[model samples]
Target: MNIQLKHGADRLLFGMKESDVKALYGEPDRKYKDEDKNVIYLYNDKKVRLTFYQDEEFRLGYIITANNACKVFDEKVIGEEWSAIMPKLEAKGIRAFEKENFDSVDNYFNEANWVIFQVEFGEVIRIELGATINARDEFDWKF
Candidate 1:
């Protein structure tokens, strides 16, 4: 079992109970049933399969997958707004820069081929999410 905590909070990462998730993030984006009609909640671009079986320690076992996969982008965007929240940037971790105004970063974003930004309490890295492709299939940052 892999356990991940955010900001020292024992927040739910993945592979958690259905009830526990409901208590935390509330209703999911969508709900569905299997061939047997077992209700399950789909959250954060993840599909949590809840199975009600007999002769088992737990009636339900969930298969978790992020529901909006785009949440990574969302998190990065939010982290940008609150750059002060992060301490520094590192490998696989997010950090925030010292600049109070994001205009400079914004300018860099539009002017440069890649946008360099920090992830709060995580890491600092560049991204090219919206990069366009050229005639030769090469990425062009002109936009």
Candidate 2:
């Protein structure tokens, strides 16, 4: 599925409720809470993890995917080397804000939007995308 920067990926939107997700995905294969108590729903077959805020908002907030079929800007990304992917992202006017290496893993994040690419051994291994603050500096609630 295509990563819709600052919005979501697949059919999951950033501000959707837990029930909304369930309606679309049915019961998760495994569900648990993260350190922040945010509920994590895993779809092993879909190769994705969805995190919904456990706070009062209680809405879908982000997606973490290791699916090799993930796409951004309409280009397959998970297995592509930086050399091949960077140019396409740039052409789409998506510029990375920072890139840091943690031993073997490297992360490229964009603050202007809301996408992070995690790479290891020169190929993207995962992607994390979330909601973003709007131009008014307010959290975007994409219901």
The alpha-carbon RMSD values of the candidates against the true structure, listed in the order shown, are: 15.1, 1.3
What tens-digit string does per-residue lDDT give for candidate 2 at 1-143? 88888889889999999899999999999999989999999999889999888873778988999988789978999989977898899898987559988999999998877888898999989998888888797679788
Candidate maximizing lDDT: 2
| Model 1 lDDT, full chain set | 0.34
Residues forming the 10-long window of minimal summed lDDT in candidate 1: 1-10
Error of 2 at 66 (Å): 1.0
